[model samples]
Target: MALKFHIVNRIREQVKAQGDKTALRFQTAKGWGDISWRQFGQRIDDISRAMLVSGLAVQDKIAIFANNCPEWTITDMAALQIRCVPVPIYPTNTPDQTAYILKDAGARVLFVGDQTHADIAMSIAEQCPALEHIISFNENVDFAGHPMGMSWEAFMALGNDNVEQELQTRIADAAMDDLTTLIYTSGTTGEPKGVMLDYANFAAQLESHDKVLSISENEVSLAFLPLSHVFERCWTLFVLHNGATNCYLSNTNAVREALQEVQPTVMCAVPRFYEKIYSAVHEKVATANPVKKGMFHAAVTIGNKMATSIQQGKKPSALLQASYRMADKLVLSKLRQLLGGQIKMMPCGGAKLEPTIGRFFHAIGINVKLGYGMTETTATVSCWDSATFDADSIGLAMPGAQVKIGKNNEILVRGPMVMRGYFNKPKETAETFTEDGYLKTGDAGHIDAAGNLFITDRIKELMKTSGGKYIAPQVIEGKLGKDHFIEQIAVVADARHFVSALVVPCFETLEGWAKELNIKYHDRMDLIKHSDVVEMFEKRITELQKELAKFEQVKKFTLLPSEFSMTNGELTPTLKLRRKVILERYKKQIEAMYKKHM
Candidate 1:
C-alpha cells in the first residue's frame, strides 16, 4: 500500500491521541526521565519553528552530529516537519570525515551532542562554507569563541508567533517524495557517498514491519545502537510511529546496565553484541564443575529440540514439552534474566551472525531476528519472521521488496525502500544499478527452494590466494570468531599462499585463564606473547576450524593486544571491518605470519 499520510502528520495524530503518555525516555543526572507525547510534539513544533526562523528553507540540509539521544530524534522529526533533509554524522567519525559530509550535504545547521562534538564542528566549521549555525544539545556546552553557536534551549526559544505560519505551511506541503534523510555510508573502500532516502522509503519500511513484527504502543525499545546508522534510526521512527517509547542510550559501554534498567521488550543490535554475550556465557560455562556443565549442555539440547519443533510447525510431544519446561527453569530462565527477561524480539544485522550464535539465542528463548540490508536499502531487505527459523539464511525477503540473483550471483533488489540514488554522484549512482533498474547490492547470495536468501560473501571482498584458491574471509572469520578465547579475527589470505590471521583475545577471560595457569606477564603485549597464551589460542583455533576445508583454516596467526577500533580506522561506525585499513595498519605483522611459508 502507498503511504497515505506524511510522517509528520502520523506523528501529529499520535500526539493528539496519546497525549500525557511517555513518548521518549532518556537518561538524566538523577535517573531515567520521560517525555510525554504532548512534550514531544511541542518540542518538534518548536524546533520546526526555530528552523524557519533561522532562515532554513525547503530542502535545506541540516546535520546531526550526536550520539543516541532524545534530542537527536526530536531534531530529526523537527527537520521533517519543516521539509528539511536531516543528514546524520556518526559521532565516532573523525573531524575530516565529519567535515566532508557537512560539505557534501551542504548542511547549513549542525546539531552537536556534547562538548566533543561541538569542538569537532567548531574546528571544521570554516572548512564547510555552507555550515552556518551550530546548535548544542548539551546546555553546558560552551559556545565561547563561535559566532553562530547557541545552546538547544536558546535555539528553541528562537521560535515565536512570527514563524508559526511558515511552519504550518511547510507541514501542509510535506510530500512522500520529499527527501527525508541523507545517510552517508561508512565506506570501507573510498570516500563516503550520501544515500538519498525519501519519505516513501521509510513509509514502505513501516508498512513492511507491520506485517512481520509484533509490536505496539506497549512495547519499549532500548535504543542501544548509534542513531546515526540507518538500522537504529529507522527502528526509532517505527517505535515512535507505533506510540512506543524509545529509551536512548548515549554510552554504548553502559548497555548492559541500561538493558537491565530499561527492561525493553524490543531492541535492535548488531551481530557483535550477541557474539560477545555468547562468548562470555560459554567462557563461564567452561569453568563450571563437571556436573553443572553436563546439566547446562542437556538443558540447551532440550531447548534446541523444542525450538526446532516449533519452527517446523510441529507440536512438541508431551514428553518434549515437559523436558523443555524443566530446561527453561534450570538454565534458560537464568540466561533470559541476563537480558532483563523481557526481550520479545531482537533484530540482529550489520554483518553475518554465525549460525551457531543464532541457534544458541533461540535455544535460550531469545528471539534473534537475523536479517540483511545496507545503507542504500534503508535497512532491511529481508528479516526473519517470528515463526521462521533458518540458521544458514537471512530469512525471507521483506514484503514489497523483490530479491533476485543477478550477474556473478550478486543479490539484486528492487523495492520502494531502496534509495533513489547517491546524492550528487550521478556517475557512481548509474553504475550502482542495472539496466533493468535493480539496485546492485554487491553481495553474492542465492535463494533456496524455500525462498530464503542465503548470503555467501561480499563479491568485492573475496580474496584470491597465490596458489589460485579463492577464499571468503568473512566465512573463515565468522567460524573462528565464535571461540571463547578469540575476541576478534582479521583473516589474511589475499595474494598469499596460505590463510593466517591477527587475533585479539578476550582479555577478561584470557586473564582468568592465565591466572589459573600461573602465567605471569607485565602488560597486555607481554601477556599475549606468553608461550602458554600462544599454545592456548593455537589449540582453540584448531578446534574451531575442524569443520572447515584445509585451505580455509588459519595456518598461522599473530596475537594482538587490542581489538580493531573505529578511531584507529580499522572498523567502520557500524562495526564493519575496514579490510584495506586493517591490512595497511598491520602490514608488518601480516607479512611475518606468511614469511616462512612463502
Candidate 2:
C-alpha cells in the first residue's frame, strides 16, 4: 500500500471520488456536524488558497493552539499542501509554554481555536518577533496591534482564489524528506524542544502500522486524544489515508458519552484513560448489593476461567463452554454495551499500562493493547495484535522498524518513522543517535525470544536508594496500579532511607469501599482521612509487598484526595505524573511520611 504521508493532495482526490461520503464529523457548542469528502477537499483547497492569498510563504511556520477540531485539521492540511511546516502547541500548555514554542519555532502566523487561546496568544504576541498574523477560529475578540486577521468563516472566502495548479507545483516541492510538522516535546525539565518530523517519517510510521493492524474504510476512529501531540496527529493521518471515518469526541470531559454516541470501531487513548475505565468498572462491581455482587463475581470467574483455559490452548468441556457463553451474554455483553459495543481496539500509549489490567481487559472482550513509541519517532515503533498479546511487553517492533539492545540495556531503534532532528538544534539532534544513527529510546528493557519488546522502566524513571538498591519504579508502579482502589501512584524513593509511594486513590472507587464499611466523611479530603480508607490501602500495600524485594517494598505511603490533573502542575499534558513537581509540591507530606527531622 502506498503511504500518502503528505495528506493534502490525497484529500483533494478523495474529495473528487468520495465527495458525498462523510469525511469528518466535528462537534460544536450547539451540537455536532459533518462535511462530505468533496466539501472537505474543497475546504482544504480553500484554506490553502487563503494562506497563499494571505501571503504564507514556503518553509514558513504557523502555530495552531487548539483542541482537536475540523479547523485544526484543515489548517494543518493547508500548511502541508503549501510546503509549510505546521507546529501545534498543546491547549493544556500554559501561556508560558505557548510563548516559548511560538518564539522558538519562529512561527510567522498563529491560529487560535477560541477566546481562551486567542487571549493567551495575544498576551504573548509582543514577544514573538516572527508572529505577524493572527487567525481566530471564531469571532469573539479583536486584537490591538494585530497586522492581519480573519475569522474561520471569513478565511474560507480568501481560499476562493484560483491557485489549484500553483498549489500542486508547491506540493511537488515537498520532498518525502521535507519537514512537515514541528511537534514540541513536553519538556519535563527546561524549554520545550521542537521535534522536526518529515514527510517520509510520517509515511513510514502509518504504512508500517497498517501492515500490522487491519484498518480500512470500514473502520471508524472516535478520537479524544489531543491532536497537538504526535500520537493523535499521526493516528488521525493514518486513519484518513486508510479511508477510515473519524468522529471527533465531544470533549475530553464527555468521552464516555461520545463513546456511546459514535460507537467507533477504533479509538486512540492514553494508558491513564484506560486505567480510569478499568477502575470505574471495578468500582461498579465492588459496590453492588450482595446478590448483584455475587452474580458479577460468578460471571467474572466464568469469564476468566474460559479466557485462561482458551489462552492456554485447552478446549473446555461443553458444559463449561455453555456456562461461559451464558455469562458472556448476561454480564460481559452488558459491559461492552456501555462502550457502545463497537470498540474493536484501542491502541494505548504515552505511558506503561498495567499487565494485569491488560489481561483482564482482554478477558472482558476489550482490546486495550500496549503499543510503544514517542513524539520524536512520529509515534510508531512497536504495536501488538489483539489475539497474540504479551501482557508485559510492547509487542513486536513494527514492520520496517529495527530494535536492538544498546550498551547499557537501552533500546535502540532505526526506522523511517524517526524524526529528522530537533529543529535548529544540531548538537541536541546529533547526541540523540548512535555512531551508526539508531535512535536511543531512553527506555531500559530487553526484547523477548519471540521479538516482543518488554519495557522494564524509563531509563530516567529508575531510582537508586541511599543504600544503592536500584528499583525500576514503573515495574512496581504498574504492579500497584493493578489494584482498583489506588487510582494513580508515583513510587518515590530517590536518595531516601527507603522506598515510599505517593498514592492518588481512585476516589469514586475508594469512596464506595468506605461507605460499604460505614466509613463516614465530608468530601474527598475527609474521606481520604478516614481510618477505613487508610486501612484499605495499608492492607493493599501489605498484600502487594510480599511480591517485592525488601528494599523495593513501599515502606510508607500518603493517599491524595484527587486525581493528578493536567491543569495542576503535578501532571504533564500527556498525563504522565510529573514526579519532580509531585515531590516538590508534597514535600511536607513526603517528609511527614518518612518522619524526617527538619
Candidate 3:
C-alpha cells in the first residue's frame, strides 16, 4: 500500500521498494526509454533538495507550464514529497490564461516545459511578482538568456544531489493533511478558481480504485492524457500505487505509433480517442478491398452479438461462439494485435461514449468501461466494474462516492474525492455546496436501482419556451453530435424563447459526403455555405427531430463557417463548449436564419 502519507511519500515508498522496476517512460523523437523507479525518485529528490536549499518552504506553490512528459510527474512528486502545492498549467493555455493562474496562485518556482511555455511565462513575468525562478525541462532551450532563471540540470546541481538521508527527512516532513496540489478549474459560470486538494483526495481515489480494479504489478499504461487534468493525475496515482509503469506519449500525433510500440496493458483516455479510432477504421474500410471490407463488417457483426450477450449476462450461442472465434482469427484479432493484444481494458471518460461503441469493443474482446465525472468531482464518479459491467449505463458509483438527486434533479456528490471549494470565491463556492455539504455537481442526473448514475443534462443549461415548457439542450446536442457530420453544436435557448442549433459539421465527414455528391469546396467556410452541404445537415436535423418532443425540436438552425476555437475564447482549454460566447457571436447570423419571411 502507498503511504497514506501525502502523495509524495507514496512515490518515495514506491521507489524505495520497487527500485529496479520501471516507473516512467517517454516516447522520444529518437525512440522509447524505460526509466527505473530509483532514477525517477532521484530526479524528484534532486529537484526538492534544490528548492529546499533555495528556500522553498512547505505550502509554497510551484507551477508547471509544460506539455506531457516524464519530467511533469517528476516535478509533481517533488512538490508533494515536500508537502508543497504544485499547480499545473495547461500546456496549450493562452498567455492570458497562464498569467491569471500563476499570479493568482502566487507560484514561487515555475518549470517551463519548452520555448512555448518559456516565451509565454517570460512575456508575463513582469506582472507576476511572486514568480522568483524558472527551470527549463528541456536542455537545448537554454534559460540563461532570460532574467528569471536557468536550465533544469543546473537548477538540480544547486542542491546536494547525493543527499539520500536529507531526501528521506524532507519526505518525512510531508503530511497527508498538508495541501498537495491546487487545480485551477476553468468553470463555466465565471473566472477560473483553484481547487485545493490534500493528500487525502488523491490517496482516497487511488486506493479505492486499487481495491476495486486490482491492476497487476507489471501492467503498463501509455499516458498521453494531460497531467494537469485530474483524470490523468488520479490515473497516474493509480499506476504508481499499483507498481505499474507509466509511459508518456511523445505527443498527441505520436499516439498511434506509441500504442504499437508500447502495446500497453491498459489505457485511460477520453471518448475522442476511441471515436478517432472508429472513424479511421470507417475511413479505411471505405477504400479497402471488397473481401477485406466484407470480412471486417462480418467481424463487427459477430462482436456486436457477443457484446449484447455479455451485457445481458448470457453466454453466446454455439453459432455465435464459432463465428466470433473465426472473426477474432481472421479480422478482429489483427486489430488487437496492432495494439499488442495486451489491451486488457480501456477506461473511457471525459465525456459520455456512445453505448454502441462500448458494445462494439466488448464484442471484439476489449473492455471499454464507461466512467463519468467532472473536474469538481476530482474526476472519478462511476466506472464499469469489469466483473459486472452494464455497457448502456455509466457503471456503478466508485467505492465511497454518494450520489443523491436534489430538489431540481441536480446530481449532489459527497465523497472523499470531492474537492475543497473553488479557491478564493466563497459566494460561488457556497452556491455549489449544499446546505448539508454535498457538492452540487450542477449536472442533472439520477441514480438507478442498481446504483448506476445516468447524467441527463445540466441544470443551468435548460431552454424554456413561451408556454413554460423547458428542455435540456445538452441532451439533444449530445444526440446530434453522434451524427458523424455534426462536429460541433451549440443548442441556443437563452432567455429568447424556443430552441435552435448552431452546428459545425466535422469537415472530414462532410467533405466525404460532398465528394460523394460530386460537390467541391475550398475550405470549411466554403463547404458550410455550399447548398449541397447545407442540405445534408438539413436532412440530418429533420431525422433527429423525430427523436425530440414537439416543444423541444430545434425550429431553425445555422451551419457555422468555422468551429469554436480556444484562441477566440469559444472553448475551455479542456475543449468544452462555451455556450454564452457561441450565443453572442452568432446571434446576428442565427436571427437571419430564423426570419419567418426568409
Candidate 4:
C-alpha cells in the first residue's frame, strides 16, 4: 500500500483537509475542552516563528521536560516544523538526571510542564551553559523573576510577521533524513543514551501501522503513556496524521476517570496497565460467591472458545455463537466498561505481557495489540494481526521491517524505522549494530515458522544459579504477578545457590484479607511481617510457581511494604526494574533469604 502519512507535514495537511475538526482534547477545571485542527496548525506556526526569532538554528536541540499535555505535543510538533530536534526528559527525572540530558544534548531552549519541572530546569540552567531560555507551560509556575524564564504565552507572543516567511521556508525544506527527535533511553545501568530518530524513522512507522491497523479521522485516541516514551510519542503523531482527535492526559492517577470520560476508540499503553486490570478483575472474582465465580469462569471459557475459533480461521458453531453473545452481554461487556466501552484497539508493549492475560483480553471483545519495539526502533516493528491473533507471539514483522535471530538468539532488526545512532556516541552506536547492518536488540527470542516473534527474556537479565541452571526471571515473574495479591516481584538467582525473590504485595487486597481473618497490625510493615500474612503469601507463591522448573521456582522470599517506584530510583521511567539498584537497596533482605543456604 502506498504511504498515506508522513510526519514532516502531517499537521498542515490535516489542517487543510479538516480545519474545524477537533485535533486535540484536554481536561480543564470545568470539564473537557477541544482544540481544532486550524488552531493546532496555527500554534505550531507561532512556536516555529518564536524559535526562529530566538535565533535557534536548524537542528538546534530543544528540551521538553513535561508530563503529557497539549502544550507538550505543540512544542514537539513546533520544533519539528522548524527542523529542530526536540529532546524529551521524563517528568519524573531528578535534577541531576535532568542536568545530564540537557548538558549532553546542549539544549538551547527548555519547556517545562509544572512548577516542579520548572524549578528543576531552573536549578540546572546554570549548569547547562548552552541553555538560553526556559518556557513554563503552567502559567502559575514561580520563575522567581528569572530573566531567562518566561511563560508559554509570553514566548508565543515573541513571534512576528517578519519570522512568518522564515517559518514557512523551514517547513517547506523538511527532508526525510532530518533529525526529528533525540529520545534518551532510560538505561537500567550507567547513564542514559540519546537515541537519534529521523523523519524517515517515523514515516516508516506511519506506513507500517497503516497496513496493520485500521485508524481513521473518527477514532479517538487517549494519550496516557508518557509522551517522552517512544511508543506514545510515535502513536500520537500517527493519530494526528489520520486527523483523529488526540486526548491529552496529564495525570496518570486519573486514567480510570479519564477513560470513562473520553471513551477513546484507540490508545497505546504498557503491559502493566493490562496486568493491573486483569489482577483487579480476578481479585474481585476470587472473593465472590460460588455461583458468581462459576458464572464468570464459564463466561470466560465461552468467550475463549469463540475467540479461538475465529483466530484459527474457523467459524463458531451456531450454539457457540449464541452462548458467546449471552456471555458478552452479561459478563464480558461489563469487564470492558472498566476501560471505557468504546475501545476498538489498544496497543500494548514496553514489557512482557503474560500470555494468559493477553488471551483474557482477546476472549473479551477488546483487541489488545501486543507489539515489540524500542527507542532504537521508532516504536513498532511487529504487532498482532486482526485476522490471525496469536496471544503467545508478537505477530509478523511490519511491512518494511526485517527480523532475524542472531548469535545468542538475540533478536536483530533492520528497517526504515530503526534509529540512525546514539546521539554523539559513535563508539557505542557502532557497537549496537552488526556488520551486516541489523540493530542488535539485546533481547533473546525466536521466530516461529509462521513468522511470529516470541521474546524469551532480556539477555542481560537472564539469571543463572550456582548449579548452572539458566533462568528467565521474567517468565517466573509474569506467572506470579498474575495473582492479585502480588503487586511487584524481582527474582534473585544470578550466581546464587537458589532462586529467591523480593515481593511487594497488593496492600489493599492483603489488608482486606487480613481484616476478614480478624488479624491486627500496627502498620504496613507490621502487616507484612505478621505470621498469617507471611503464611498466605507463601502458599500463594507455591501454587503460582507450580508450572516453573524446580530450579526456577522462588524458594525463599522477602515481602516489602512499598512498591518499587521511580522516585526511589528502583525503576526506570518506563517502569522496568533496575535490578542492580533493587539488589543493592534490599541487600539485607536479599541476604537474609540465602543466609541459611549459604
Give the TM-score (vs. native) of candidate 2. Answer: 0.94
lDDT of 3 by residue, 1-598 (tens): 2456346666767899899988998966678888899999888878888888777877899999988889898888887776678999988788888889998899989998888788888889888899999888988775547878778889888888455566677676666667778898876557788987777777778777876676877999988788888888788878887778999874778777788888998989887676666656666777689999999999999887887777778988999999989999988887776666789887888877766567667766788878888777778888887756766678888888988889888888898888877777778888888888899887787878888788777788777765688787866775676666667778876554677788887777777778878887787788888887777678878896676787777877888877788778888766777878877888797787557523
lDDT of 2 by residue, 81-192 (tens): 8988899999888898899998999999889887788888888889988987778886775655555565777776876547777787887776776678899999556567
Model 4 residue 168 CA deviation in Å: 1.3
Q: What would the TM-scores of all predictions be?
A: 0.99, 0.94, 0.93, 0.99
Q: Which of candidates 2 and 3 reaches a greater TM-score?
A: 2
lDDT per residue as tens, model 1, 1-598: 3445457777998999899999999998898999999999999999998899899999999999999999999999999999999999999999999999999999999999999999999999999999889999999999787997999999999999898888889888878999999999998899999999999988888888888888899999999999999999989988888889999999999998998999999999999899989988898899999998998899999989988998999999999999999999999999988888899999999999999999999999999999999989989999876676589899999999999999999999999999999999999999999999999999999999988999989999989989899899999999999888888899998889899999999898899899998898999999999988898889989999998999989999999999999989999998889999999999999988777776
RMSD of 4: 1.2
Error of 1 at 468 (Å): 1.5
lDDT of the structure predicted as candidate 2: 0.81
lDDT of 4 by residue, 433-476 (tens): 99999999989999998899999999999998899999999999
lDDT values of the candidates? 0.92, 0.81, 0.79, 0.92
Candidate 4 ranges with C-alpha deviation above 4 Å:
1-5
